[model samples]
Target: MASRRTALRPPLVSEPDLPDIVSPAAPRRSSDLRAAIIEVDGEADLAHSTLEQCVLSGSGSALDLDGATMMDVDVRDLRVAKVSARRSTLRRVRISGGRLGTLDLSDSGVHELELRDVRIDYLTLAGCKAVDVRVDSCRIAALDMPGATLSRVAFAATSSDEVDPRGMRAEHLDLRGLDALGFLDVTALRGATLTLRQVELLAPVFATAAGILISD
Candidate 1:
């Protein structure tokens, strides 16, 4: 006789009533001028600058754009080992290619920042506040967002191996097209909205985190 497979029962705990999530607003084009090319090896500050088809190349602590604001910029490649923009802001900025070792935007405020077709080894947005942030068609090895606050953030057609969201707060977090393999801590997703498939995929991890045992 063949053994029968048992179906896993739904959790007995009632689902929390969550409000509707909002999508991030897309960035608006700021200018009709040609983009400027900036290729530097050390720390540079660019304020009220519009760059297009720019390529930044350097090593650790090589680029810092603190208190700088960029609009209508299209950065094609970033080859820096580590880039930090703690207090800078960007609008209608696009990053298309190149591999970044670490990109840190901690304690910064940003609106309408878009990252597409890029590869980041480690991304840190700790203690930062952002709105209308979009990441699409990218591969991130690890993401750290401790103590961060975000609104209307969306991740689409992206793959992240590990995400660490401890002490994070978010509103309207859209992960509809995310292909996440590992979440370092699922407890950080308390106030985030996910699709049905995402919930199904992460149910086991959530159960383990809640100390729920499944018996056959």
Candidate 2:
């Protein structure tokens, strides 16, 4: 019998029923946004802000949410060039149907987060501590996770052009559904699970790393 931990548990995200409408105002420090659409026209400094049960969607050149805390938030249909939430904390957040040039969440603590139907040029979670996260049906040009710690993370029906997981620590990380073109550090996937087709696809890369030559 397979252990419970062997299976990837989906993120427990509560859908937000937002009814309030918020004006396009620059968020102040420690702002509390609830049940509203937080739109960012240009750039908003959302550091130390708390957003609960709200929808955040907009088009902007840059949006920064460093050190912000979000719970039960829905981030939908955002067309941003650069979206950064470094060192932020997120729980029960769902980010879907977004097009972003760069999405950086370095050094953040993320729990029960789901990212689906998003297209990103660069998606990085470097040095992050994430649990119960899922990226489903997304297209990413580059996915970087150096020095990050991931638990019960899975990528379902996702595709990435490049993946760099150097020095990453993962437990119950399932990458069988990820169709990645390249991986920077294959050894960093020690504790992750991959399907036989993925293993066969990476066999040459593994052999190259081991300096093994097969000529038949």
Task: Provide backbone clash counts, one per model.
Answer: 0, 0
lDDT of 1 at 3: 14
Error of 1 at 11 (Å): 32
What tens digits encode model 1's per-residue C-alpha lDDT throughout 117-173?
889999888988877788889999998889898777788799988888898987767
The residue-by-residue lDDT of candidate 2 on 56-137, one tens digit each, is: 8888898888899998788889999998899999988888997999999999999888899999999999999998888999
lDDT agreement of model 2 with the native: 0.86
In candidate 1, which residue pairs get closer than 3 Å at backbone N, Cα or C atoms, i.e. clash?
none
The C-alpha stretches of model 1 lying farther than 4 A from their native spots are 1-35, 41-61
Q: Each prediction's Cα RMSD?
A: 12.5, 2.8
Candidate No. with top lDDT: 2
